[model samples]
Target: MKNLAWLSLGLMIGQFAYADPIENGISFTSGDWEIVCDNTRTCRAAGYQNEDDGTQQPVSVLLTRAAGKNQAVVGQIRLGATDTDPTDTEVQMKINGQNFGKVSISKDGDFLGHLSSAQVEGILSSVKKTSLIDFIGKQQKWRVSDKGVAAVLLKMDDVQGRINTTGAIVKKGALTEANVLPALPKPLITTVKVKSSPVQWNSTQLSQLRAALKATFKSDDDACSMLTDPQEGASEISITRLNDQKLLTSALCWRAAYNEGYGYWVIDAKAPYHPVLVTTDASDYQEGKITSAQKGRGVGDCWSSESWAWDGKQFIHTGASTTGECKAVAAGGTWNLPTFVSTVR
Candidate 1:
């Protein structure tokens, strides 16, 4: 199984200074507006053209909205490494009816939008600044959506609103809908269970072994750093027998994948015996490749990292995991799953 990390609302969204006027290429609905944020941390309004529903445009904008909130917008967008020039690369934004906007992000990679100032004041008119609680008491439902940019969606959440206020923001009376970007789907990591010898392992030791397994899987894939999202990648594992003896010791192990081909590792030292470093089918990794020096450290076909000796017991180390929303490439359908790594303990 893969280690998929789900980033809760608290970790995904952040606040930054607003910069640059709306660019010309980006067009918004007469009443609807859209913004594109690229990987470089730049946000900008993308230019667009609207036609009747029957129009022949093959590429349509996809949009996600916050629940109860009106007119969703793309909150944060990212650019590809090759896509250095925002204007040249076409970033798509969609929510509700689709085609919210299409345009290149600015050179600096940032964009911002307000409802023409007039719209903001109009929405605020109903609220009283003194007793703000009563002024905007209506609930806002928000959903997040965007095109698949590969690794860009990692660490992003859709349902969570972006705000620094201590309390939730509510709308009272008939307030025009607010448009926020759709949240990315959470990624799924691999799930595994490690088995150690019952005689040699205690509950506390088992828990410690489990933790060690989790760490091994994380270090191998770079999933911790790359943001493992199993939904977008593939993963699988195998168990290898180490020693040949009358009372044999065995380890239940897991090796999974995320990203293009990043793999995760999970292991359990079921017995006191440690397995000898052997050849792995994996490439870019091998036996005895461990960075930390100790006895029995090695690498092989395994790609991510290597195994380590933890607490007098030998354990494997892999990579970290991450979560984000993504659309399936073939269907263009929405997908979301929380943390990918299932409990191994």
Candidate 2:
């Protein structure tokens, strides 16, 4: 974290457009340029030119009067080289010269992290360069290059060039088809909080279980897409066929053990017996992992969710280890479900 001077040269330029008091001038000895606005609210500076391709690019820095006397410094801050490219650009925000976090546009032009923010000031800095060009391009090169704001801004002209070459198609001049596929189904959570011993469910838990089953069924084809196979698959709920046609409607319910984006399937099932819980892991051929969790209370099971990750081998259940375990095997991501409705006649 480089501590910027309260009166950096770049801050002046940002203030130039907002407040009208900015004045541009040359640095006498540093040979760097500066912009000062409103006498005190904003200030900016550029670094001495570097000789790369005989191009002396400016490294712009800016500072603004922040919430208190503490000033907010922002603009392009160079970190180092990428695997191939020599320079990587990051949008830096600081308070009173101390570093806050940054959002770096990798050498590959990928925006990494709106990362951790120490305060609101950091958030503001992120918004400033959400779509900056040079800050994004320099990292794509296979060698060292200047990653200054001016350089990036210059490169943005290339992006504009591409857009112009493609030529924008007016919607009114084009015939577009409507989106017919349904939206992704919403997640359903169980409401029962069953505790130790004789467990039972309430309307909330039953409703949640119904919704969860619906989502699971709907997710069948979608989940199957995650598998290696190309065909539709079957999924099932397991319960013992206890009595001879003794009307049994057991719903599955269990607390999730992992989080989202991990390999897990959230299920809501329950049986007539006490201590009924359901938890499972899911994966597809494409998007690897997804996990789901649910917990029950004393005779009142309330399912909650947690997440976990997978490494193509086994599921890394996040949080801590649990006694409850359920698995949702994926075949092209479609559930290879076991028998669902098995009862004695």
Candidate 3:
């Protein structure tokens, strides 16, 4: 069966942050505002152009804030870069038809200059009330709806425990900000140390082993339909030496139009060969890591990928992320938007 990790992300939204020592991540959406937070409690909230404003432009503003007392909220404006995207190199910021000023393009063309402290303060405060936020260019103008800005920012404040604090972006007061959550250091992961080499096993034994692995997919036939279908070969078992006590095994498990997945597991090197499954959506394995990369859609505009490191005894999840908002800016999207980050030794 395909791993359920990807689908689980969406279902896990709004689950409260800093609930434990280390959280994989959390996401939340309110109207046009969406927030994606990482393991370290660094959050990025993105607000998109109004969908019903007669014309939809692929413009968005990202508000990023790290967890800690008195951390500043940084904002950046991103204009779409797809074939259908805007070509304007400059844009004007307006709130309620009042011109804020010209937003100049920096050396990095993806954004106009990032909002200054004064601009950030103004926008956050304005969005909390009934205000029209817009960016007008020579050719086109885009409006970022304020419908959900207040709610989304409020949630951000809550997630970081900034609500009611002087540092809070939503509702600020004289409350002390000394107790706001501090930014936790990133979790560290070490890579697998042993070098893997292939080991040959009896052909009949391989077939039987493959069957056992397939049986592990007893449910989620719809999400992992390939498991229930018999199109895959049964003798596709592959075994490799992971360490002195365990053997790594893999078999073709699923196939899609532009990608295929293999199931990887670990078993006893000796007889009985009790197996423990790792993942069924793995696309490829190398040195000491397994990875999966799949396009978000047929256009190949966006992609999501994950990786695991075979750390000495067991496989450890190392990373999982999607490229930033899929505006067709690049073939696989433009920026690294990781939900999980770990340094491998």
Output the number of the lDDT-best candidate. Answer: 3
Better of 1 and 2 by lDDT: 2
Q: Write the per-residue lDDT of candidate 3 for residues 1-345, one digit (tens) a residue.
A: 223532433233344443433377766677777777778878888777666654666667778899989789998776664345566777888888877777765545455457667667768878645788888888777777776676667767777878779998865778888999888777788766665899998877876676666566665553334544665434367888888999888877777887777778888887667788888888888888889887877777578889999878888988877765555444556455667878888
CA RMSD, predictions in order: 18.8, 22.0, 6.8
Which stretch of 10 consecutive residues in model 1 shows the poorest summed lDDT? 129-138
Using all chains and alpha carbons, the TM-scores for the candidates as numbered come to 0.22, 0.20, 0.82
lDDT of 3: 0.72
Angstrom error of the Cα, residue 128, model 2: value is 14
lDDT of 2 by residue, 75-163 (tens): 33322231232344555444434455545544553222233324333423332232221222332321112224332221121211211
Query: What does candidate 1's lDDT look like per residue over 1-345, in tens digits?
Result: 112221322232322122222121111121112333322222232212122222211121222223223333332333222112223334433233333444343454332122223322322232222111101101211122222211122211122232321212221233233433332322222322222222344566544433443343435564322223334332222333222221112232223442122232323335432323222222232232222111111212112222222222233332211111121111211111111112221
Q: Quick one: best TM-score, which candidate?
A: 3
Q: Rank the candidates by TM-score, best first.
A: 3, 1, 2
